[model samples]
Target: MPRQPASFLPIADALRTRIRAGDWPVGERLPSRAHLAAEYDVSPMTMQRAVERLIIEGLLEGRAGSGTYVRTPRERLRMVRSRHRERRGGSPFRSDMAEQGKRGTWESHSQARVPAPDGIAHRLAIQPGDHCVRTAYEFLADGMPVQLSTSWEPMAITDGTPIVLPELGPLAGMGVVERMRTIGVVIDTAVEVPRPGRATQEEANMLGISVGDLLMRIERTYYDADGRPVETADITVPDVRWEIAYEIGIEQPE
Candidate 1:
């Protein structure tokens, strides 16, 4: 689809100027939606959309049952993931964000048994139309969303096992390696390929950012010792809120 111009961009720009000029100082309440609509000669819906953009930009805050107001900006923080092989248990978030003074948390939605598309099936080395358990996750840092991830696992490998639901049962949230071990799957390796891209409107909305924001997209897969593909996931992280660093170890040859 061709890129469509959002009606709120100009409005957002105007409001941003006012905010930066101190016309509406931090903590000042913005005019009511109706008032702004009349001022801008647009519908209230368009005005609301404009305000929402500012809110996502950290320049405004909307109070529940109350009006929107200017918000004091907070320092932006970045999260890290170390590649040290020893750190292979529960989510890296627990250790990674914790060390950076943020409490890391994640919530997953219902797990579904669905037919794998040809591409996903190929990633898992399963037949097209084969069943897989799919789960979606939103990861947070100190209560603010930081990442979105969706994982698919071949039911042929996890069916009839406690680890079928990646985020449930005995080993919930324990990361992939430990969870697979419970079912006798020795996860020996994981592969990740990260690509940078601009976020679409849907993804922008979910991450509380404006459309076309830069983001890091990572595709990861886990393989067992026997070279069987067990799981794969797509992870998206907002570029403004995260920086990806790769740490590699060098080996000496005798």
Candidate 2:
């Protein structure tokens, strides 16, 4: 048997219709939960649930010390993933933002000599306890955070090299491919797997979105010319603000 929809779903649908009909204009505050509950003859908790559903769908937003309001629709920016980007030499992220006329910046914290756990070890083809350098980055466009990444690189590959710390040395803020080249490691290829997920409390706080908002999580690994994994990272992007685009190159017959 098919399960029936939740009681609040109908109310949510009605609220959505009202919003679309301009019952309240964009940026206008919604009526209080208690008032709506009384109007709908339901409990305040039920109305709250319905309102939350709209918020998650990007139709509404909540402000601290204020009330929920209709959300002003935001333009979704595209983040392109392609081999051509890697070949651009400088920071790919900065270049990406520049294409959109937005200033790109990031803050990163690198921890040295961290032990790799089982999952990270498998990704890097190293022992579970192998020492690695872990770096966490918050990427911003126009001073607003839009992406997050945590990367791990085997210390054995860069232990005594000048590029040991990703955010330090002469190539500070350079990408993985350029940084690895400084140590004689030729990064030739990369693989990325993207999955859809919900934002956790921590991720929500970082991205300034509601908990349980949609997110795109990408698992990426870079390989050397010899097929050895040089770096692995997990990247997070909020789906509400960004879209992922892939560029593929096709060769013509000679």
Question: Best candidate per lDDT, number?
Answer: 2
Using all chains and alpha carbons, the TM-scores for the candidates as numbered come to: 0.77, 0.85
Model 1: per-residue lDDT, tens digit, 200-230? 9888878878787789999989899999999
lDDT of each: 0.84, 0.92
* Deviation of model 1 at 31, angstroms: 7.5
Model 1 spans with C-alpha error above 4 angstroms: 1-4, 14-48, 62-70, 85-88, 110-112, 197-206, 210-214, 252-254
The sequence of per-residue lDDT tens digits that candidate 2 reaches over residues 74-164 is: 6788899999989988799998999899999999999999999999999999999999999999999999988999999999999999999
Candidate 1 — number of clashing residue pairs? 0
Our model 2 lands, by Cα RMSD against the true structure, at: 3.3
lDDT of candidate model 1 versus the reference: 0.84
Q: How far out, in Å, is residue 120 in model 2? A: 1.3
The model with the greatest TM-score is 2
